[model samples]
Target chain A: MTLRANNIEHFYGSEHILHNISLEIMPKKITAIIGESGSGKTTLLAILSSLLKPTRGTIYYDDILLSNIKNIDLFRKKNIGFVFQFHYLIDYLTLKENIALGALKESDNIEELIKTLGISNLANRYGNEVSGGERQRAAIARALVNSPSFVFADEPTGNLDTKNAIGVFELFRNFKDTSFIVATHDKKIIDYADIIIEMEDGYVKNISSQRT
Target chain B: MITPLKALRKNKFKTALIFFSMVVAISAIFLISAISNGIVGMYSTMLKTDGDIIVTQRGIADTFFSDINYTIKKRIEKISNVKEVNALILGAAPVDNLPIVGIYGVSENRFDSYKLISGIYPKSNEVIMGQKIYKMLNSPKKIVISKKEFNVSGVFKSKIGFEDGGVVMRLDDGSKIFHKSTSIFLVSLKDIESKNTITDINHLNSDIEAKTTDNFIDNYNQFKIIKTSSDVISALAFLMGVLGIVSMMSMVVNDRKVEFGIMRSVGLPSKTIIIKLVAETIIIAIFAYIFALALSYIVLEIIQNTQKFQGYINGEITFSLGALIFFTSVLMAIVGTLLPAIWASRVDPMSLILRGAY
Candidate 1:
């Protein structure tokens, strides 16, 4: 079932940050959220992921309303994954442990994922010892390891150089069966989207569909 | 659950600071507790070392100076629960021009409890000295007194505190030397329940003070031992514990602010974030506890061996089994981490993205 947010509103103290945001995220499709700075794009994504609750709206996963679920952690673990710009891997753990940490249940085949990501040689090294590209890749690997229905990336390649940014975007593109809502201002990231959503001043300004 | 050991390994300096503070806190607690235990133990041993009930002269104001009628020794034996009674005399005597020797007189048969490590119990006019006193005398072969030379019996060990600095002799010898009736009656109770018998005796002998073993020991402890050291040390330890938790948690919260923000952004609930923060503190506390225990053991061992503190300080090495300290440390860490964890969770996702903290 697809994830849907209806007329979501968010606030910061007495200040309203997001207004009347509605969106539906289908499974196995790429949906890119593009916006200028302070456009509430990240807030909308956060609300969809259920990280932040909308003050005056309803969110539903399939027909089961998310706001009614008592166990948000279980829902998030089962249905959602997240990647951030800085790739906040625990510096003490090896790459494998960092990736496996995202999964609610343990898997014996983490080495397979490491091999798939071509990070087998770097698996034993600490997160601090790895390059920026490798760290970003590890974050992607962590997000995907949970096998959630959707993956949310908030400027996932924001900290990377042009080459690493392209590589990370390619990795996101390769996960075709996992819905993607990547928030970025990177033109390269925008060009690779199947559905482009442009946001400004806490509202959706433009949306366009493209042939994958 | 994340292994705090691995986390601590990543931040060695910070971990060391936290560990140091924990050690200080635990050690202070250990030291204070040990002293309290030690004082109580010393008094208990003093009472148990002699007899069940000690009858001292009333109105004398001090047990050391109180002189009881030696005939009361026979009268106490007739009391219910009294198994045997002995008269004892305590006095100070010069040893090699040093006034450090405490003299005690007892019946020859009652010397069974006195374990002689080097010499035998005194017979007739002979005297047995304590190990420390004997050593202080440079292992004299004989001592002359009152125009007579008495052969030294073997050196003996005593569990009583004053005996460590004195000599023990038979009552006849002590009477011959001091020319006075023994001052105290040491009465052995037939069983543990005989404490009630002593209460009855106190009722009967209105002019005398009859005390049970514990009461007698407690009185002696109040008079002889210094108090307040434990309270002072415990207070200091508690303060250091609070400081340690505050500093460690503050730094940890600051370092993990972004991580907490991201967790909040990704649909992790606030309650879950709070639980995670508390769990992380508990994890850190466990590490600190283990480290503190190990360090306390090592430090205590070194103090025990180097300072020869067996008699001076009661630093018994013991593992902390009580959850109070553990719970207290975790509570402090949680309290310390709460404000920052909440602050991080409350960060606006849009602002975080704009400021590039996420």
Candidate 2:
């Protein structure tokens, strides 16, 4: 399903964070939201994920008006996924349990996801015990565990080294059928995006479609 | 579940402090409740003597010190449903300069309930001393009755409060020794269903107060317990228990803010997170309860062995059914955790991700 944010305006208290932001995130494609610091890239992404309510305008997940849905949790859990810059894995849980949490239902293939993330050896380790790169991979595995229709990642590769960041970007690109909207300042990720949206001062500056 | 537990494990010192605080609070409640129950049980059992009806003089001020005339005893025996009526006289008497001996006037035939440990019922003006008091008086060679000496018949075991501190004698000898005409009466009813019999007896003599023995004993025991400072102790115990639960719950919830935030960001509802927290608190409380029981028993045992309280100071510790303590502690923990959990759930994922707080 295509994710659309139309003329969205967001405010925290009385301070406006995003103003008249509009964008469409296509299914089976990767969309990058690029902006300088304080450009409201994260705020815009949060509104799309339903983690933050927009003060004005509407969001539609395909034909469903997300703004009108009463139980955003059900919609978010069933269709939306999130990957944060820092992995917020539960420190008490093993990597496998942390990944499986996103699914909300236990599956034997949770170990397969851990293995695919090259974190098989770290499966039994606590979140705090793993390296940052391993933690990021585990975070990705967690986001994809539910096989959600869309994923919203806020600077997922921001904390990683060049090699680790490239690895994560490739992982994002490999999920061919799942749509992704990544908010970041990294130009390297812009090259891999099917669509690029630029933001300035909480407003969309430009939107471009890249020919693969 | 994993997230919260991990957070708890990571901050081992903080978690342990919170856990210990919870244990102390829960244990305090458990200990107080157990001791209160133990003391009440002991007193109630003492009041459950074999008599169905016990008659005491009306408006005599002090029932223990009131005198029931021998003629009145005969009159009570005439009432229907009253199979037998026995007069018992109780007073304080000095034993070997120790003001601890209780003097009892009992009939020879109905003295079997005393369960003579090493002596027979007094035959003549002889007297039987309680084992504890008998031992305390260094097992006196002879107990003087009506200024006449009689050999100590034997030590007897009694579960009654009056018997706990002294000796028993025949009513005739007791009256002459105390220089009083008559005292208390213990009446056994053949059938408790005959409530009208007591009313009729009361009507027959407005000056006489005839009551079901159970009610009399209950009232008497309740009066004694209230007078003996048990009520104050029980109230204080209950208050401490409530406070302990509240304190523990607040501490645990306050310490786990980030853990709760992690759970919320993963799509768990605020309610689900609360349930888990309450469940965890209950589990902790259960552990504390067991610990409290053990500790109370140890304390009671030490008190019994060292201080030697005459009343039931050390009985088995018992927790109330209906999961009252468990539910109360859990509820307190939930209330304690609620605000913090809500605040944690409301944390914006953007702030958490951008600030790298998680």
Q: Model 1: per-residue lDDT, tens digit, B19-51?
A: 667667766676566656555665466546657
**Per-residue error (Å), model 2, residue B85:** 2.6
Which ranges in model 1 have alpha carbons more than 4 Å from their true place?
A13-16, A106-116, B56-68, B78-81, B88-112, B116-129, B133-155, B159-162, B165-184, B190-200, B214-239, B259-314, B317-358
- Tell me the DockQ of each model, to 2 decimals: 0.28, 0.39
lDDT by residue for model 2 (B1-358), tens: 4445555566666456555655565555555555556555554453345567766778664555667677776777787778877777766666555644567777554577678888677877577887766766678878654446767787787554346556788888777777665665677778877588788668766667878766765566445664356446544544554455456545555555545545555666667666776666555555655665566567766754441344334344544522565665655556655555555556654444444453
Instruction: Enumerate the chain B TM-scores of all models.
Output: 0.72, 0.76
TM-score for each prediction?
Answer: 0.76, 0.82
Best model per lDDT:
1
lDDT of model 2, residue A73: 63
CA lDDT, every prediction?
0.71, 0.69
For candidate 2, list the clashing residue pairs, or say none. Answer: A92-B6, B52-B213
Q: Against the true structure, whose TM-score is highest? A: 2
Task: Give the DockQ of candidate 1.
Answer: 0.28
lDDT of 2 by residue, A94-151 (tens): 8887787657564355777777779999888888888889998988888777777888
